[model samples]
Target: MPIDIETFDESSSDELNTLTNAEMVVRFLATNDDKAYTPSEIAERIDIKKNSIGTVLSRLEDRNLVRHKGDYWAIGERETVRDAYRTHRIMEALDERYGEEDLEEWREHAAEGE
Candidate 1:
């Protein structure tokens, strides 16, 4: 099988470079922290694909960046979310200053047990 490479126009590329699904979901829930909403509601509010919302929510929950109960989700603890967001910004700044870290290179050097 062969893969095709499609060129993206400026407008489309700009959209593609925007926030990741996790970032968008976190920001949306943070902004409306007082309320918990179903995945469908969050998807509609944030303009993300509904089908992908569950995966995003699950990952955030694993990081303790978001909470889930019944069929609804909400931002996690104030301090935890704040700390996570701060760390994220710091990493972005470091990546911009120094080219992004190569995961493959790190993996190659990682200790056997790790």
Candidate 2:
């Protein structure tokens, strides 16, 4: 299911003030998942600078929380993003101990001839 709007109330400026710029951006996009928005548009709504929004957007995209469609950006598939983040954390931990090549081999072994 898509995220519940009440999960982060976009209508409450008081609640919005508690979040960092990145969190605010995520909440904005998540609430507005019905449509895509340009960075400038997001910045205007979220009270962030248009020029500085790129880094925030890039960070969210890197973590799979947001995605772009042509020039506009939107929230990503929630389940897929969650799964990707979990896998990313697992890989980081595995790579820290066993290294990438060893982790890759381990993954292949775990696949059981798939």
Best by lDDT: 1
What lDDT, from 0 to 1, does candidate 2 have?
A: 0.77
TM-score of every candidate relative to the true structure: 0.79, 0.57
What would the C-alpha RMSD of candidate 2 be, to one decimal place? 9.5
Model 2 spans > 4 angstroms off: 1-17, 80-114
The lDDT values for all models are 0.82, 0.77
Model 1 residue pairs with clashes: none
Candidate 1 Cα deviation (angstroms), residue 14: 8.9
Model 1 / residue 44 / CA error / Å: 0.4
lDDT of 2 by residue, 1-114 (tens): 233568545335554345678867877787788999999999998778889899999998888799997779998888866576468558767976887676678888989977
Q: Write the per-residue lDDT of candidate 1 for residues 3-100, one digit (tens) a residue.
A: 11331332244434676899778877887889999999999887889999999999999999999889989999999999997897789779879989
TM-score of 1: 0.79
Candidate 1: residue 3 Cα off by (Å): 36
